[model samples]
Target: MTVNPLATPLSLPARPELTGGRPLGVLLLHGFSGSPASMKPWAHALAERGYAVEVPLLPGHGTRWQDLNKVAWTDWYAEADGALDRLRASTEAVVVGALSMGGSVALRLAEERGSDVAGLVLVNPFVSSTRTELKALPVLKRVVPSLKGVVNDIKKPGQDEVGYPRLPLRGLAAVLEMWQSVVPDLPKVTQPLLYFRSSVDHVIDPSSSPTVLGAVSSRDVEERILADSFHVATLDNDAPRIFEESAEFVARVTAS
Candidate 1:
């Protein structure tokens, strides 16, 4: 499959820093169907702060919806976990910044990797769905390979999320299954968390924030409201706020 240029992975070494002699690191992850394009701006911001940054294109994405359908949730997690390992190899500490499904994968990384993940910066993270249709995904996916498009939920005019034009049912089911494993291990996510939630999101269900905030054992959890964005908050009007605040969050947490 021919991947779009926007889908290319980003790997930047942190600039020389005197803070602790070793530069810190960050792993930014995009949402379902979406590619690294959604994360570039934010990753650049952190990289500018002398932090090593990586934005890896997830498996089954940036090509076609049919490709995503054949992927399992485990594949996404493995890629994220590997990126985290790579970042840790050079930096003194690490923070994970994620959007939508990437947030779900981030949670699992925190759970399994423990304190190696210094902190979390999540934007419009997706967890459980209240949609009644999802309950029938097992049967529904077998009947149909896809549904309408779930990409480009940004309210910013002329913005293209550059994700699959259609939603793959089998792929959707795979991500939802990840919630089962993550939710149960939420208590293991004790890292300081900076969560960005869109007040007017069209793609993510309202139930998502509550499920995560209610279970994470983090003692330094802060939830900020994105008043002018949607599910793809990284590409929305409130993107600047996410970039600025998340950088601060990473600096503060990694310093501690």
Candidate 2:
């Protein structure tokens, strides 16, 4: 349960060099079983561009996976949603940036908050799983608390995700439920979208991109393929592109 320094939350205020026309804030969310460490660098990049940024350490994460096993997906969403609310208080508009399971939380926020959410930047996002075994998770989790983790799927050497070493089954089942809820409201996500997908990702499957691109009602949607990266594209070889382009997206969307 020893906390890694990178796992801590990050909060930065808007600076004089702000990118957009108005005060804009961004809330970045990390994936399941993962810590804020995965998104810290990305948060700093946005903060440097003069955007208010918040990277919350989602509940039941950044600690032992056993704690993750005790919480549901709702807990994660609550943390993300609260962060968005807090950011909105000081900014004219907000953008949600997410990786993996964090994407689900972002989509739900957009679906519910509508115009308040200025845009979205998703990297290797996941909303559903084709893995057949998940159907039994509701029952299986009663017996098993966790499995080995699926973290640090980066092609870049020396990259570390700092995620929990185990996969929490209770949380996994709850996230699947969140996916179910988000998918149905995809049409409500009308904000501009910047979607980044890793062509060689090992954690995310092929279905997520199509599901989001096909269902979202957003008129401004851009899909970028990370051909050289894996699941954790934020820390992968193409990470600079993700950071740079996302800042650009934030600027374009927040500009009035």
Candidate 3:
């Protein structure tokens, strides 16, 4: 579980900023094996509109995938939880936005924080997988360190997510373990939610979106289907819609 300090150079740093204008803040989280880079553009989009934004680089991510193997789900969730605390300290209210596994963390935050979290915006979230192969992770991780890469599922040619090229089995198991614990508590996420699902996602299964939508207690839930993006829609063709619509959603939900 100890990380090599030399691996830090492989990933980018966390993004944090304070806009003196509004009391509203936005917390953005990246996906598993991914860094804050995935959420950077979205954070910028929100920041340009004068909202404070904090996009944290999760533990063991943004570096070598091997680093992720050293940390568990609690470590990752703790990073997001800490970010929420920091955001809440400086702003009147906070909204959370995430992509992929980040969405799972955001859901957990909303569930635990209650009225402290103003709203949620998620893109291509992953909760559980019906894939039989993944079920073997409980044992496979003991022998295999990693499998193939799951990053850069973008349709945009030549574009890359800069995430780990290899998927750490231990890390993947930690995420799935978190999913198992979070799924049943989905009903506690009563905050206003905006969920984006990609029609042709190769990474996440089709059932994830419906499972979340069906379980969450949020009466103010909206689902948007992305016709032209993959798992990393934030950096894909439909990115503009994601950015613009999320900004609008934040305004709508946080309006006075």
lDDT of 1 by residue, 1-256 (tens): 8888878889999874634566899999999989999999888877887889999889998888899999899999999999999999888899999999999999999999998999999888888889897889999999999988888998899877789989999999999899989998998899999999999888878888889999999999999999998889998899989989988888899884
- Which window of 10 residues has the lowest lDDT sum in candidate 2? 14-23
Per-model TM-score on C-alpha atoms? 0.97, 0.96, 0.92
- What is candidate 2's CA lDDT for residue 210? 89
lDDT of 1 at 194: 96
Worst 10 residues of 1 by lDDT: 14-23
lDDT of 3 at 33: 81
Q: Encode model 3's per-residue lDDT on 1-256: one tens digit a residue.
A: 5433422222122223433345788898888887777777777788777787888778988667888899988897898899888878877778899999988999999999998899999998988777889888899999999989988999988766668889999999998989878999999999999999999999988888888999999999999999999999998999999999998898778776
Compute the lDDT of residue 172 as modeled in candidate 1.
94
Instruction: Give residue 221's lDDT in candidate 3 (0 to 100).
Output: 95
Error of 1 at 77 (Å): 0.6
Off by over 4 Å in 3: 1-21
What's the CA error at residue 149 for candidate 2, in Å? 1.0
Q: Write the per-residue lDDT of candidate 2 for residues 1-256, one digit (tens) a residue.
A: 6666878888999874555346789999999888788898898898889999999998888777888877777788888889998999988889999999999999999998888799999998988777788888999899988888898999999998899888889888888888878999999989999999999978878799989999999999999999999999898899999999999999888887
Per-model C-alpha lDDT, please?
0.89, 0.89, 0.84
Error of 3 at 53 (Å): 0.5
Alpha-carbon lDDT of model 2: 0.89
